[model samples]
Target: MLVEYNYVIICSDRDFSLDLKFRLKKYEDLAFVSFAKDKTEGLFVILKHRPDIVFINLSKNAPEYFKMVVELRQYFHNLPIIIGISNDKQYVFKAIKNHFFDYWLLPYSEWDISKSLLHAKAQIPEKTEPKTLCLKSYRDFQYLNTDDILYLKSDNNTTCFTMKNSSEIIAYKTLKVFEKQLPEQFKRIHQSYILNTDCVSGINYGKNLCTIAFNNSQVPFSKSYIKNIDELKKKLAQSAIFANK
Candidate 1:
């Protein structure tokens, strides 16, 4: 997924600010830029927008610029700050020491800006993987952990998830849709039921029922699905043998 990074520019020069905004807008889909006339206004904009990256002009006023950096770092330590410097190489060492993301000498090129933006994006921490299933129903969505689900029962076009908490969640999607996305641990034991193999306690071959000891519930399997039961028993026996060894 492409992450659209929101950024803000802090500079007092109007003409330079407009030019920077124009240059940054060239990559509109990758970045969204906002502007602030000075450090005071920049702080407010930063607080409001919570931008992923920030660009500050350091050529005109170095002291005030670093002051803003100090203030920003107090609240947002990880924010990527790109410094705009003049041809004077003196500021480069300070920029490096301050841990700035990147610095561009005066007369910004499209390559330099693009490189800095890409570097800033790389500094952002990767998003954590989602552990729960998000099910949407009409106006809102519900989140349920994959481990919490004991089994699923299908009723016509709707599928209901029976959770460990003894509560059920009804989704509009079909059982086949869920079967495709669910982990391999979920097995189809019947046309109406999908059982979590991890939760299966025992099987009653005489009654053709699989018992879930987690919830003390029994689900029936069809004649066509009896092979699944045999497979389950074989797996259990293999597991038992392994444990003994």
Candidate 2:
């Protein structure tokens, strides 16, 4: 899944917010961007967060809710998916006309919500990033499949590549040189370390460290690059559910 961190905005009251949060507690990927009580507040939150999905509460007002979302298209080049939440099916036609991605009942159904989320995730295209990396050192070019590489470590001017097969290759380039070249999956967690987000098995915030999935080798992350590490967590959590640990 080549998905970045997906921000979510929910427009509802305090009680609905709490219920929704509890139902989606297991999904480590989805981010609840902010609190929005209605269309007025939702529009502001949507602009600020640029959320990928917005849940509109139709409890108080249904027709106006649909109209507001249609008007939102003018604000964004690509408007986020608007999901309507209501007890009655009366707003179904309006939701369809307004182009809502999905609809939910007031008292949420775990199964229905799960299906909608998974369906939406599958709709997103993947494998858009370049999978192969070419390292050229004076016409001696080496091609590496990005999936086979686990992490990168910098030592002065040279960068070390740790492969999934436990082999290492030294490149005659600074970490900064390849930082921008690599795909989004490669995150610079520290000055000396850049790990593949896919290979991360554990993140210990208290210890200020992350460990690879297969090897369990620890990588130290500094406070300055903590946000990168935070984004990494969301990356790994993309498009899937896990059995409870």
Q: Compared to the true structure, candidate 2 yields what TM-score?
A: 0.53
Predicted structure 1: lDDT: 0.79
Please report the candidate that would top TM-score against the real structure.
2
Q: What do the candidate models score in CA lDDT, each in turn?
A: 0.79, 0.80
Candidate 2, 170-245: lDDT as tens digits: 9999999989989878889899988898888888999999998878888899999999988877776785587877
Measured over all alpha carbons after superposition, the RMSD of each candidate to the real structure, in angstroms, is: 10.4, 10.9
Worst 10 residues of 2 by lDDT: 1-10
Residue range 171-207, candidate 1, lDDT tens digits? 9999999988786668888999998877888788889
Candidate 1's TM-score reads 0.51
**Pairs clashing in candidate 2?**
none
**Alpha-carbon runs more than 4 Å astray in model 2:** 1-7, 125-245
TM-score of each: 0.51, 0.53
